[model samples]
Every structure is written in C-alpha cells, then in structure tokens.
Target: MATYAIGDLQGCLSPLVQLLEQIQYHPEHDTLWFAGDLINRGTESLETLRFIKSLGDRVKIVLGNHDLHLLAVSHGFGKLKRGDTLAEILTARDRDELMDWLRKQPLYHYDESLNTVMTHAGIPPCWDLHKTQTLANEVENILQSDRVDDFFATMYGNTPDKWSDELTGLDRLRTITNYLTRMRFCDENSRLDLESKEGVNTAIKGYAPWFNYPTKVPHDCHIVFGHWAALEGKTQQARIHALDTGCVWGGSLTALRLEDKQRFSTPCTLNRKKT
Candidate 1:
C-alpha cells in the first residue's frame, strides 16, 4: 500500500478528483496525507469536506489556517472574508457533523516508520521533533477540550510574535497554532514574520523561509507542508515538500508519492477569484 502526500484542496474538488485519478488512489489499501485548507476559496467547500470525510480511515489531515478560520466562523467567532466559498458548508445538512469531525483533527501528523512528518505549515526551526509534537499537543489539548469556545474567541492574533516556553494560557496556545498553521517566514530565533505572505524573494530582510533555519530535526526526515502556495511545490530540498500549488488560483494540483518520492500533478482549470 503506497501513501500520497497531497497539497491543499482549497475547495477545488474537481481538480482534486482528477488528481486522485492521476495518482491511482486506492481507498481500501493506500493512504492519503492531506496538507490542509481542505475547503474554501474555490467553489465547492461543502462537497470537498464531505468527500474527504467520506474516506474514513484512508485519509489524514492537519488543520490549516483556513480550516481553523472555518471552525471559528462556524462557532460564530470569526467572519467570512471576500473570497470565501464556505457558506454552503455552513448551511449544509451535515454542517454539525462535519464541523465536529473537523475540529477534532490535530495540527500535526507523523509517520515514524517513514520518518515523514506533516503539518499545514513547516515546523518551527527552533523546535526539535519531540518539542514540536509536545507543543502541538498543548494546543490540541485545549482545542479539543471544553475550553474550545474560549480558544476560538482568542485565536486570532499575531502578537507575542514568538514562541516562549514561559508563555502561559491562551497566548501559548495561540503562538503554537500560528507557528504550525500560519507560519511562512521566521528568524533563526523562531520569531515569526506573520505579515509577509509573498514568495521567498520578497520576504523582508533578515527573514528567510522557515525551512532555511537550522533545526533539531534530523536532515533525513521528510516534512510535507502546504499553506504557502507561492512556492508551487518548490523548496529546493529533497526531503522538504512544499505542495500547495495554488490550484484555486488557476495553478495545478500536486501530490507526492511517499514511497518513491515521485511527484504527480494535474493542471487546474478554475478561474482565479479576487481575495
């Protein structure tokens, strides 16, 4: 049974369907690791969520920034932005069921056998594998607890801009969430550059891609992440896969077969929507 690490779906269900066909995905045997943004910004958020949810144990997904935003909006804690296509999901018959399943997803996933890890964004450079998983669990614990409502209410912010073991309460959880889900650039010190969303070339001075920083993770370990569509599946590192190909912006949907490290892509046909 092979495993395919896929990029963000972003509600582009048609391309995802075609991509699955291209990859010869076998639901009963093979596994799929999705780098989040499973819905929103395209045209079929409801269908995409339902389709992924239907796969049961065959699929795994980490929560992306968009996924958390959807969770917050569903709970009436956040507002929909201009390019959102999540209204259908909000009004769907299975809305409660889907949201329940969604909120239960973790922020990171790892396959010890393959030494392959998956998160919506790359792991923070300062964190070792153990610390990464531990800190991720800190947020996951609160997010899945009775305090979830309060978590969402306080989830939106760029403050405290860095990780500190000394940070307590919601601030720590929020920082962890941002690093795992929203991060793109950061310093060697792990101070996040939350505002720069452009490509590496445009990253403000002294800030480079998070993957550029030295980390405690062994060099051989593979990290599969999405979120930064501008990379177009390029990080120039064989072990690091940046798989968000901007399918919602008329780019292609891409997937990496973990077994052989072969990459497969299907061109997207959706019209770009202004955000």
Candidate 2:
C-alpha cells in the first residue's frame, strides 16, 4: 500500500519504466502520483500516455504547463511548437480518450493522514490550502463542463498578477492556472512574477522563490512538485521536495516513496529536443 510520487516524465518512458522496476511497483497494491509533464520533449509521447491510461485508479496526476499546452494544441486552441513529441499523442488512435482523461485530472491533490499535497508547480505564497483548493475547483468545474473549450480559449495569460476575490471570469481562471502550473517567484506583496525562470541568483527584480518568501510557507504540510528543473532538484526546505531532476535534459527520473520519503532515480537517455 505504498504511494510513490514521480517527477515530470516528459515522454521519457524508458527511464520511467526503469524507475518503476527499481521501486518494484505493484499495481495491485501501490499508488503512483505524477507531478505532470507526462508527455513532451522526449520520443515516446504515445507510449507514455497509454501506459498511464492503463493504470486505472492506481495513478494520480496534476496538470503541468506542458500538459495544458498539449490539451490546447489538441483542440486547435494552440499550435504545437517544433520538436514537441505531442504529435505522437495527437495522432494516436485513441487521441480523444487520452486527451479527455488528461483534462479531467485535478490541478492539485492532498492526503490528510500523510499531510502531503501535490501540484505540478508550487502553490502561490498568498494562498492557504483552503483558498487554493477552492480556486482549483473553479477551473475544474469549467474543465469538466460543456464550456471547456471556452475555458481553454481564455487559459493563457499572467494577468490579475495577484490573487484577489475581485478577479472574475477568465482572468480568475488564468491566475489560478498560473499559480498551479507556471508559478515560481513572487514579490513582497505576493504578486506572482511570471517572467522569471532563472535560478536563485538571477531572480527577476524584487521577486523571490515562492518557498523562500518571508511569510510562513505551507511548511506544516509536505509539498511535492516538479516543473522547476533548474532548481536541479534542490529545495532548502525539508517539507518541500523538488522532484524534477531534469530527466528530459539527460538528468535522472526521480521518485519519492511516500511512506518514508525514500528516493529512487534512474539516469535518462534524452535526445535534447526542444518544446
């Protein structure tokens, strides 16, 4: 009955398989949590998606920015970038089923007993778990509705720069998605600074790492996330874990055993395709 959290697979199925073998994962008894980017950059997008789909109730995933991009691209709301492995998925025979399943995944997950919370990226510094879950439901409702197309249409943006109860409609959805997927840095006022993607030394002016902000972090609970591979798998906080070890860039695919937080990693064989 172990639960294991894995970092961004990015369509690198070989390393994923190796890591699964290393952990001796049992579908009948174990659960797997994915930090998203389940497909892209690597060569086996179709295979990766199918593997996950076959997992039934044994797996859980939070959507990443790349995952959202794949959904938008599939529906013609966005265009695929060159070097993206998503084409394999878009052309798959079971494309509709795969895409629909992906869209239904929650943006965040929480476990009460373990006090572990998972999202593709870090939660905003200004948001407590209650507010974060509430906002997550707002988008989830749209994603699960007939208006889903309209939701994806308004999905891209960094506007409303900070969270406010006043934010409504598409602006509010965009802000929530950014916090759950693209967020990294924030200013003193807790406004999300979407432009900075560099390491700690090169932070965009006045912005600091979301976890390093002056206020008390969601430190009372264990937080597991990916998407910031440039952290190169480093987080200064014990309760926070950075699992994206840059596997798509020739680093290792990482997995954390939930019961005792034991780690398992396997070297990647990446082709370095940009997405």
Candidate 3:
C-alpha cells in the first residue's frame, strides 16, 4: 500500500485527476493526504469537493486558509473577494453536507508510523509536536461545535501575532488557526509575519521562514505543508515538504509518495489569473 501526499488543489480537479492517473492511484490499496485548499480559485469547486468527499476513508485532509475562508463566507462572515470561484460550492444542493464535512476536518494530521505531521501551513517554530496537536484540537473542537459561527466571525485577523499559553477564547483559536493555515514567515520571537507571502529569499528583515527560525523547537517528525505555492515544492530540508506547485496558476500539480519520496506531477491545463 502506498500513501501519497498531494498539494493544494484550489478547485483544479483536472490536474488532480491527471496526477492520480500518473501515479496510478488505487483507492483500495493507496491512501491520499491532501494539504488542503481543496476548493476555490479555479472553476470546479463543487466537483472538487464532491470528488474528495467521495474518497471517504482513503484520504486525510487539513483545512487551509482558503477552506476556512469558504466556511466563513458561507455564513456571511467573510466577503467574497474578486477571483474567488467558490460560488458553485455555496450554491450546491449538498452545500450543507459538504461544508459540515470540511469544517469537521482536522487542522493537523500526525502519522506515528511515518513520524510525519501534515498541516495546511508550516507548524509554528515555538511548538513541539505535542503542543501542535493539542492546540490544533482546541480549534477543531470549536469548528465542529455550535460556536463555529463565532469562530468564523472572528477568524480573520493578524493580531496576537505571537502565541502564549495565557491566550484565551477566540484569540487563542484564531492564533492557532493562522499558524496552522496561513503562516509563512515569523520573527525571531516566533511572532508571525502574516503579510509576507513570497518565497524564503525575499523574507523581510528579522523575519524568516517558520522552519528557518533559530529558536524553533526540535521535532523528530517530518513536516508536510502546501499553502505557499511560491516555494514550488522546495524547502531545502529533506524532512520538510512544500508541495504546492501553483497548479491553479498554470504550474504543475504535485504529489509526493510518502513511502519512497518519489514525486509525480502533471502540468496544469487551466490557466487561472493570478490573485
């Protein structure tokens, strides 16, 4: 049995299908791990959601910032920005079912056998694996609860750029969500620089990629993430994988085979306008 970790789909289903064909994926014998952003920015949001949902137990996924934004927008908390392509999902007959399934998906996934942790974005430099999982659960609980609307309402912010155990309520949940889903660079003290979305070379002064922070906690596990398409599947660290290859922006859709670390990609046919 093989396990494949795929990058952000961004509603680009054709590439996913082509990549799966290239990898010769077998539903019964293979497992798929998605680094989130399963919808939006492309033209097939509804089809993408339905296809992933149809996979059932064969797949594992974490919510990306785009996914969260879709959830919040569904509730009228977030405004639909230009270039957004999630209207199909919001208007689908099974929209409630799909949204419920998405909101219930975990913010992080850990595989003990592989000693790998997958999040939509990189883990915070300050968090060890245990702290990471625990904090992820805190947000997961609320997202799957009656207070989910409250979460959506306050989920869009860059405040409390640093993490502290003393943080309470929505602040704590929002902070955790940001780190796990939207983070790219952070300062020496682990304060997230939420505005910088470029690659590592362009990091703002005193701010570095989360994985490059000097004070980062050590972890024996490998990390896989996909929010930063600018990295183009390169993190320079063998254990850290950045699999988003910008498929929605005419780049290739990438998949990394976890067992052998073999990568397979299919050039995207969709030519989406960069956002």
Candidate 4:
C-alpha cells in the first residue's frame, strides 16, 4: 500500500481529486496523510469534508487552525467571518456527524516506522516528540468528552502566549491549541510570537522559524506541516516539509509520496478560471 502526505485542501476538492488520480491513489490500498486545513476558503467545504470523512481509516488527518475554527463555530464558540466559506458545512444535513468526527481527530500524529511526525503547524521548539504527544493527549481528552463545548468556548485567543507548566484553565487550553495549530515564529527565548507568519529571513528581530531555534529536535525524524501558505511550500531545512502551496490562492495542490518522498502536484482549478 502506498502512503501520501498532502498539503492543505482548504475545501478545494477538484484539485484534490485530480491529485489523487495523478498519484493513482486507491482508497482500498493507499493511505493519505492530510497536513490539515481540509476545509475553508474554497467553494465546496461540505463536499470536501464528506469526501475525506468517507475515506475513514484509509486517511489520517491532524487538526488544522481552520479545522478547529470550524468546530468552534459549530459549537457556537466562535462567529462566522466575512469571507468564510464554511457555510456549506455549517448548514449541511450531516453537520452534526461531520463536526463530531472532526472534533475527535487528533492534533498531532507520529509514525515511528516512518520516522515522521505530522501536525498542521510545526511543533514548538520546546516540545520533544514525547511531550508533544502527551500534550496532544491532554487536548484530545477534552475534545473527546461530552462537554467539550467548555473547551471550545475558550479555545480562541492569543493570550498566555508563553508555554508553562503552571498555566491552567482555559488559558492553558487555548495556549496549547495555538502552539499546535497556529504557531509560526518564536523569539530567541522560544516564547511563541504568535503574530508573525513571515519567512525566516524576513521575520522580525528575535523571531525565528519554530524549527530553526537553537534547541535540538531529533535529527533522524521528518516533520511535515502546512499553514503559513506564504512559506509557499518551503522550509529550507532538511527533513522539514512545508506543504501549504496556496492552492486556494491559485497555486497547485501538492502530495508527497511517503515511501520515496516523491512529489506530485496538480494545478488548482481555482487558477483555471482565466483559462
């Protein structure tokens, strides 16, 4: 069976279908690792969610910021935004089922055999794989509970920007969610800058790409993430792959063949309007 890691789908289903066809993906025999942001911004959020969710065990997804935001909005913890394209999902007949499934998805997934760790955004420099899995379990518990609305209600924000063992309550929950899904840059001290999404060279003083910080991440493992489409699918660091190629913004949808790391891309249908 083949395994593929794909960039953010962002509700752009047409390109995703074409990409799968290009790779000759067979749901019965292949696995797809989605780097996340599976919905939002594009025109067919409902169709995209239903398609992926139908794949069931054949697909693996890590919760992206947009994915979580959809959950938050579904629970009435967050409001719909002006440009949001998630109305199709929110208003879908299977909204309840889909949202519940999304809530149960994990924030990080690690594969020991593949020597790879996958998240929607890169892990914090301060977190080793073990700590990341532990913290991910913490949030996962809350999300899996019957009363997870309490967690989602407080999940939005940029406060408590620093990670600490002492942080508790909603502040702690939000802080963890931010780091796992929204993080981009960090200061030299390793505190999440939260606001900066620029590249390493253009990052403001003291802020560096999360993976570029001084501490050691396991050099033997590979890191795969999306978000920060402005990275335009770049990491400039070996074994670290940035897969958000801005398919929603007229770029191509990308997929990385897991066994050999061979890449295949399909030009986005969003860009085909002019053709």
| Global lDDT of each candidate | 0.90, 0.87, 0.90, 0.87
Which digits, one per residue and each the tens of the lDDT, describe model 2 over residues 95-208? 999999998999989988788989988877777888878888888888889888887898888888898889888888988999899988888777988888877666877888
| TM per candidate | 0.98, 0.96, 0.97, 0.95
lDDT of 4 by residue, 149-180 (tens): 99988888888888898988778888888988
> How far in Å is the alpha carbon of 216 misplaced in model 1?
1.0
The sequence of per-residue lDDT tens digits that candidate 3 reaches over residues 230-257 is 9988988878999999999889999989
- Quick one: best TM-score, which candidate? 1
Better of 3 and 4 by lDDT: 3
Name the runs in model 1 displaced over 4 angstroms: 272-275
The C-alpha stretches of model 2 lying farther than 4 A from their native spots are 214-218
Cα RMSDs of all predictions?
1.0, 1.5, 1.4, 2.2
Alpha-carbon error at 264 in model 4, in Å?
1.2
Give the alpha carbon lDDT tens digit for every residue of 137-211 in model 1.
988888778889999999999977888889999898899999999999998798999999989898888889999
**Deviation in angstroms for 135 in model 1?**
1.2
